[model samples]
Target chain A: MPNPTAAILIIGDEILTGRTREGNAHYLAGELVKVGIDLRQIRVISDDHATIVAAVRELSASHDQLFTSGGIGPTHDDITADAVAEAFDARLDVRDDARAILAAHYAARGVDFTPARLRMARIPEGATLIDNPVSGAPGFSIGNCHVMAGVPNIFQAMVTGLLPRLTGGQPLMSRDWMVMVPEASIADQLRALAETHPEVSFGSYPFVQEGHYGTNLVARSTDAAALEAGFAALQTAFPEGK
Target chain B: MPNPTAAILIIGDEILTGRTREGNAHYLAGELVKVGIDLRQIRVISDDHATIVAAVRELSASHDQLFTSGGIGPTHDDITADAVAEAFDARLDVRDDARAILAAHYAARGVDFTPARLRMARIPEGATLIDNPVSGAPGFSIGNCHVMAGVPNIFQAMVTGLLPRLTGGQPLMSRDWMVMVPEASIADQLRALAETHPEVSFGSYPFVQEGHYGTNLVARSTDAAALEAGFAALQTAFPEGK
Candidate 1:
């Protein structure tokens, strides 16, 4: 069976404007890969309603799971919840459950539940909440779309809580071999080796350090035997101390 | 007139698998912002031919300019040039000019131009070469789509050579202000302030540090006067040390 596929939609003006470098997508990609989910695509888009809604709908329909990070805050610019609701054609309002969670958390700290803060309680109808351990503001999951915070800490916490609940396939295994040779010198042989093992995927990453050119060849596969065989082939092709 | 719009397509399996963190998008985003180009979206996809071709065609048609990084190396996994050609319905073959460039560069280093290395000379028909100062392999531009190397140093060099030739708008100016208050407490005021300045764009980034909550508000505009005016309004709304 094919591994479950996922797509990530990162929404924020700070990322688009280059004011903030995104860390959530990279974090999620690693986690998803470990869980045997194929992360097919990741898109970073501006904080706009139409764009967010379109991306959410398209990604959710195509991929087995969709994760979105950013724009779910109490600021005036936060519009992710509303856009998601519009995408699913669901009603959006401040639910008592979400409000209660926020209210109690804020009350414990002796903070007022200001109207602006209440905006965080607004969720789409028929959605379940994703707990935020770092902050009180909860994320939500409507159908296949799981919405999470933009902040690295909070996003990590939410993902930790969410991943185990989803079904996963056999985890992919990867092995790497580094050789002090330029990629072009070995391209034909590498291509022939890859063709010999159809089940495994091969990738060659070139680097230049200290006036020396080298390539890091990585072999990946869900089957451990295939991965090992591919790695052995790669090692034999470019033995160390050559 | 609005700023010229562009989209980026990052092609690599390592990126999707989280084996490598991409740096080219962030670098390109910052450069595009400074030159007044609106980077509308960035999509990271794997090295699969069909996927790369679809993304290349879609992004190239929609945006005024399309920048693709990765999959243009000499390895078996590198297939970006062929995918790009398929996207534009153009033929792919090794041209004499590209081969000459590679041959000269390799000869200077006293390296043999193997058949595998010659693969780097393949260029889509009717494409102009984008120089790679860091490496001998050249990137190309077919239509508005500029295909470049995935390596950070080579990509940066190509972008430096490319951006100066493209049309640019007025450089964007921005100012940032930080306040030691939760975003919820200032959302309404911020909304009002943003409404007052139609020419400027406001963004609120929240943070929690040292048991204190705060927000960093950023104002951006192509017009320097409008940006300054927006900054003043933000300062008046959230006075410092208050």
Candidate 2:
């Protein structure tokens, strides 16, 4: 069976402008891998509504699931919720459930839940809200698209709560070996081995650590036997401590 | 003036698998900022030729310039050169100048330059080579798109070499003030300031450092005076030292 696939849409000016370093993509990719879903693509766009809307539609149509991070804050650039609504052709409104949750969360901290704070309660019509365990602002899911906050802490908590509910496919497996041989000298042999293992995925990453010419060969497959066989062949090509 | 914009296409499977944490986007963003070009969007796609071609076309059409990193290695997964050629309706050929450079580079290192190494010398027709001061395999540019190696060191060197040759607009300037205020509580006041300064782009980023409800207000503009004035107003809104 084919692995379930998902794409990440990181919508924020901060990420694209190099003002913020994104850790959410790595977190989401790791979590999705654990749930047997392959992260097919990751697109980081500015907070422009058109770009967000276009990316949402494109990724949602291509992948089994889509997760977006950023641009849902109560500021001028916080237009992701509206963009998602427009992309799905749905209406946006302040959700009562989300409001109550945010109100209770704010009340617990002795902060008044103002109208601007209610912006976080807004969700696309007919979408299911994913509760944020770290912050009161809830993430929502419309069809296969999951929209979450850009804050790493809040996004991670929301993902942990949402991942268990997803229907996963075959788990991804991999094996890796480091070699001292130059990449070009062994490219033809590696390509032939790659063709031989049709069920497996092979990657050769060149590295120059401490002024040494080496490459890391990794093979991934769902079939354990085929994966091991491919690894064995690759190991024979380059012996250790050479 | 509108911010000078550029987009990035990260072509690699290593990124999707969470095996590699990318530093290229950050490096390019910083480099572009020095050249007064705003890095507006960055998308990471698997080393699929069709996907690369499609993304290159889409992004190049929308943005001022498109920069691609990775998938130009001497391995089977390195299909970036072929994909870029296909994207621009050009043919891939081993350029004589590129071959000479690579051959000389390898000869200097006392390494035999094999045919597989010749794969690195291939360039899309009607493209200008982007020099790799550190590595021998040069990156090249076709139209508004520049393609570079995925390795951080090599990619950085290539982009640095390419930046000076490109024309850029005014540099975008920014100033930030750390405010000990919740986004909801200060949203109205910040909104007023933003409205007053139409030329500057203002952003409020909430943070919880040490369980404190605070936000960082960043004012950005192409006009240095407007940016500084906006920062001053934002700082006045928040008292010094809590």
Q: Compared with the true structure, what per-residue lDDT tens digits does model 1 show for residues B139-241?
A: 9999999999998999999999999889988777889999998888889998998899998989988888997888888999999999999898888988882
Question: What CAPRI-style quality would you assign to candidate 1?
Answer: medium
For each prediction in turn, the share of the native Cα contacts (below 8 Å between chains A and B) that it retains comes to: 0.76, 0.61
The list of candidate 1 runs beyond 4 A from truth reads: none
What TM-score does chain A reach in every model?
Answer: 0.97, 0.94
Clash pairs, model 2 backbone? none
**Which 10 consecutive positions of candidate 1 chain A have the poorest summed lDDT?**
A233-242
User: Which ten contiguous residues of candidate 2 chain A have the minimum total lDDT?
Assistant: A233-242
Give residue A79's lDDT in candidate 2 (0 to 100): 93
**Per-model B-chain TM-score:** 0.96, 0.95
